[model samples]
Target: MTGLAVVGVADDTDGPVVHLVTADERARHCPDCGARARRSKDRRVTRPRDLSVGSRRPRLVWAKRRWRCDELTCRRRSFTESVPPVPPRKRLTTRLRAAAGAAVADQGRTVVQAARDYALSWPVVAGAFTSHARAVLPAQPEPVQALGIDEIRRGRPRWIPDEATGIWQTAVDRWHVGFVDLSGKQGLLGQVGGRTAQAVIAWLADRDQAWRDAVQYVAIDMCTIFKSAIRRVLPQATLVVDHFHLVQLANQTLTEVRRRVTVTHRGRRGRKGNREWELRNRLTRSAARMRGEHVDALLDELSNLPRVIGAPITVAWNAKEDLLDLLATARTGNRSAICCTGSTADAPTPTFPNCSA
Candidate 1:
């Protein structure tokens, strides 16, 4: 390539460089007008970085010429020759711009870093990154049938008071197979108001009717806002309450059991040291002991319950058993059985047998 002498050469400690000559046969035509006006009014030379020629860093030596138009009725009297393989009215070469774009888009590097690496201005680097991202980023996906909504706390900054804190909410649309972060905002739903029902509805409204009809099930916690949104948008879909929220209700009941047991035991005249400690220990061991394969441990613990706190212990034990029964009923795939346990009073009687599920 060095044998083809279309331009001059400059060698430095950093790299080998080549310059473009405007006096060549190919350089005579005006780039803007595409006219063969060889009479040059003015000339300017610019050196731009190019893709590496073999092992050596190559440079595009540009020779810009302002040539007078020979046509009488042309609006402009003169125009510059257009450079090949480079963007018009831009100094940086296409190869350098592309490298800068890759650095920003693929690597998440800042425009400042990209500019410094490519030896370009900040705006040039930013423009390249933006252009590349616009070209490559995937279009927003179609909506799914099922959706999940939840809120997350946003803590106060060190500069702000704790009471003035806010939160960033998010919603997820659960497809039968997988889930998508359909926060209704661009680029994966990372928005401040993303958790609102309005935002979710807005997102669904943008999708096609086929996508809307494809939804068969919508699973979410019992948030009224979310429920309202789901009913409004997916009237035909079945709304399934998330299992985790049901479990949480049962957990809350267990907490109430602890409180009630503590109160009832303290009312006894002689209950102070051993008796109180035993009751507290029993309450703590309830769920932990029953978890997974520790059912035998739980049974053994329940069997050895102290006679002094037997009544409260029996109440908690019965509640846990009822809860398990309810869970079994829900998981049996019978819609009628599940529907029968819907009311707060009828379902898990939040007292002696708190079947929370």
Candidate 2:
């Protein structure tokens, strides 16, 4: 931008195209000898990409000059004119790359989405994001009081031919593990290639001893790989099952129980006209969110069903509600549990199975 000057503007099918050229230069000095070059080598023009002007993208055409440093004693001979925004040999401007990176890293746009919006290749956008991440991330992650680790299916998996093995193999892993700073303002702390214990260990091993020691709790789903890795790396940190997974497990168990009861009593799966099917969604909803009349109606309907058909479902529903109630105490740092299994009407007593912090 410093050395660049707008020559003119023209209309295009997409938007306005801006023409740019280098400003009149003061005497060019040789890099090594500090002497000006009297002879010109050649001149060339390059087209570099920039950020979009509006809804549509504008084209950029730049005319640059190549200079010959005529100082005899100096080792440097020829160099190309460059500006801060549009550097030499770069196809995209600095601002373009920075904007692409920010779209993905800050605005939560995916790499493919940013690349499509910028009319660039996926690799270019991904490289820009890597640069942006390095600019933002610390050399060592800040010490976290509580850490959360989870697995995500990043994108559709691809299979490509493995040249050396002469066989087809997965090009990239679909599953990735993301680490988060649960106890502080920083959101996503790091990500790794796989959801394996080794991957988690590798990331944790990179941290300093003091940073690892500061982690008081590690919150994760019911994943043994993560649990094992935490035990090996940060043995002092307590393992806590996150609330989302607990609620998910409760819902899954309740659904399974309802399906089995429906088949046993009705001699078939739930259909649209079936009362059991009609109440399926209502049963999963939390009691606190339901109106008083709806709650009473739901209770009356379930109670009127055949005792054998309704009893098991009623137990499962009650268990889910009780578990939700226990989880409410988690904010106070209280560990509580209720038996979410078995048909016993009594609430489960507190018990934690394995040795944990």
Point out where model 1 deviates above 4 Å. 1-193, 267-293, 300-357
Clashing pairs in 2: none
- Clash pairs, model 1 backbone: 20-61, 31-81, 31-82, 145-215
**Candidate models: Cα lDDT each:** 0.59, 0.82
* Candidate 2 lDDT over residue span 1-357, tens digit each: 666889899998878788888874642555457676677788888888888767877788887677898767778898777766876679999999999999999999999999999999999999999999899888887888888899999887788998899999877888999998877778789898877899999999999999999987888899999999999999998888888888889989999998898898888998997776788899888887889999899888888877877788889988898887777655544454333356653643332322121
Q: Estimate, for each residue in 1-33, the C-alpha lDDT of model 1 and write its tens digit.
A: 221246567887667667765444554555545
Tell me the TM-score of each prediction against the true structure. 0.47, 0.70
Candidate 2 RMSD to the real structure: 6.4
Q: What shift in Å separates residue 166 of candidate 1 from its native position after superposition?
A: 19
Clashes of each: 4, 0
Runs in model 2 deviating more than 4 A are 2-44, 50-85, 99-126, 272-274, 332-357
